[model samples]
Target chain A: QQQVKQSPQSLIVQKGGISIINCAYENTAFDYFPWYQQFPGKGPALLIAIRPDVSEKKEGRFTISFNKSAKQFSLHIMDSQPGDSATYFCAAITGNQFYFGTGTSLTVIP
Target chain B: SQTIHQWPATLVQPVGSPLSLECTVEGTSNPNLYWYRQAAGRGLQLLFYSVGIGQISSEVPQNLSASRPQDRQFILSSKKLLLSDSGFYLCAWSMLAGFYNEQFFGPGTRLTVL
Candidate 1:
């Protein structure tokens, strides 16, 4: 069974526009949510993460909005740039294991 | 700073050939280790994890197996590789169960079973 679900397998956004990716989880035990960005031929790098205690967390151009009741979270990228084109993955940690949602491929067109 | 290493950035092997992939971590001890595989255009799949030396927990039952002979070394092996085993492999390490601990991954290794 897929524990975490992500929407929009692929997305294209204009440069300087907002790029958003949403994800949902079924397990309420999850306490930590993290997003990872991976470029072609490169390992995934942690982007931004949010704990359930906070409703929102922002860092520079990246922000993570979380809803604990709905078990949903989203990543919003402000001023999207062409260099931001990459695959994004959202993962949740319950206990010691992490479960990842299906990835989203985002392309910021200049 | 902590770093992870995986050998043979890319490999192409014939079917039925034995395979071995190695991963090691530096600047840390008694870390929780993990092995993950990703297919083209797919999400990462957890394959194996080890919390300490000689302790391994497998997430999937496949032709592959994993071993941790030392505190910082993890190995993935297969007696006879299958064509479907082609994918990118990643190794990660995290501080043992604690608050706000995050995993750090290696450069990754790409293996193609021909």
Candidate 2:
């Protein structure tokens, strides 16, 4: 069973526009939520993370909007650029194990 | 600073061949190690994890097995490779056994089972 569900298996956005990807989790015990960005032939790197205590956390142009009551979190990329095109994954960590959502492939057209 | 290393950036092996993939971490002691496999068009799948030396916990029932032969060293080995085992393998390490929750990943190894 997939503990976390992510919507819009793939996304396409124009440059200078906003790109949003959302995820929902069923595990209440999951406390830490993180987003990872992965490109072809490379490891997934940490992009942004947020805890349930905070409603939102932003780093530069990337923002994570978390809804604790709804058990959902979303990533919003501002001024989307072609370089930002990559696979974004939402993960929930419980104990030492991490449960990952399927993944969303984002494409920013130039 | 911590560094995680995974060798043989890419491998091509025929079916029924033995396989070995190695991962090591530097500058950390007794880290929680993990092995994850990513198949085509699929999310990362946890295969095994270890909290200490000589300890391993398998998350899935498969032809692969993991071992922590020494501290900071984790190995994934298969007695005989299966075509379904072909995928991108990643190694990750966290500070402790439980939820202190940041995992640093290695560059990853791509294995092709022909």
Scored by TM-score, the top model is 1
lDDT by residue for model 1 over B45-73, one digit each (tens)? 99999999999999999999999999999
Candidate 2 residue spans exceeding 4 A from truth:
B97-100
Q: State the local distance difference test value for candidate 2.
A: 0.91
* Clash tally, candidates in order: 0, 0
- TM-score of candidate 2's A chain against the true A chain: 0.98
lDDT of 2 by residue, B1-114 (tens): 889999889999999999999999999899999999998766889999999999999999999999999999999999999999999999998874444477878999999999
The local lDDT score (0 to 100) that residue B65 gets in candidate 1 is 96
Model 1 ranges with Cα > 4 A deviation: none
What's each prediction's TM-score?
0.97, 0.96
